[model samples]
Target: MESVAVVATDRAERYGKQLVGHMSRKISGEWTGQSGYLDFNGRGRVELSAGADALKLELTSDDSETERLEEIVGVHLARFGSKDGMSVAWNRKSSEAGTVQGPYSEEDMKAFAEARKARQKA
Candidate 1:
């Protein structure tokens, strides 16, 4: 599975490390953190970098936990990085036969975006 999320912050690398570190503490898994990359449990990896206007997180995992991983990372980072509001959505990055599928088809992504907007407004 692969996904990405943009967090509203300039401290991308720092937040990335912090987020992974936080997860390691909360979950029973082995994780390693570097400058801008984190590998967790040999099953997943997260990369963080500064975008023009936001922090970007790229996550890839070897299981059917893409959506859940997105939520876990997004919610925690958003809580740490913002107070106004935060929205975390995961997009599928591939459709490989042996890899996990992402919600990236044009139609699905469109529908997902619409739904997210509606949910946020409520």
Candidate 2:
């Protein structure tokens, strides 16, 4: 499977590690510090790994579904890592995978956060 690697140049490894922890809980996946995997139930599985300066992410499943999965993961990551100006740019290498796109906008992110809050209150 192919993966997208990104560096949070201004963020520390602890930040990446903590993000994975939150992801594990939010997605109900098994986690181990800076590395783990998320089984999006039936959508797909995402493998996550983090280094001192980078986060490596990979999704395994049909190509058609990965685009949505990428958006989901990217948006959440961007939301959590917003303080550091997080941006995820998928390095698409095959035709199966759709073309890469820009990150979520501030307006979109605000809506996402509000939705999350509403869901949590439910």
Q: Top lDDT: which candidate number?
A: 2
Kindly list the per-residue Cα lDDT of model 2 for residues 1-122, writing each as its tens digit.
34464645455445455656677676766657667777877767877777767777777756667778777777667666666666777665564443343345778678878998999999
CA error at residue 56 for candidate 1, angstroms = 1.0
Each model's TM-score, in the order given?
Answer: 0.56, 0.69
Candidate 2: the clashing residue pairs are none
Q: Show pairs that collide, candidate 1.
A: 92-102
Measured by C-alpha RMSD in angstroms, how accurate is candidate 1?
Answer: 9.3
Output the number of the TM-score-best candidate. 2
Candidate 1 per-residue lDDT, tens place, 1-122, comes to 77766666555556666766777675533324433655566667777776555767788886676666666666566555543344445555775322222323456556767988999999
Off by over 4 Å in 1: 10-14, 24-35, 95-122
Each model's C-alpha lDDT?
0.60, 0.66
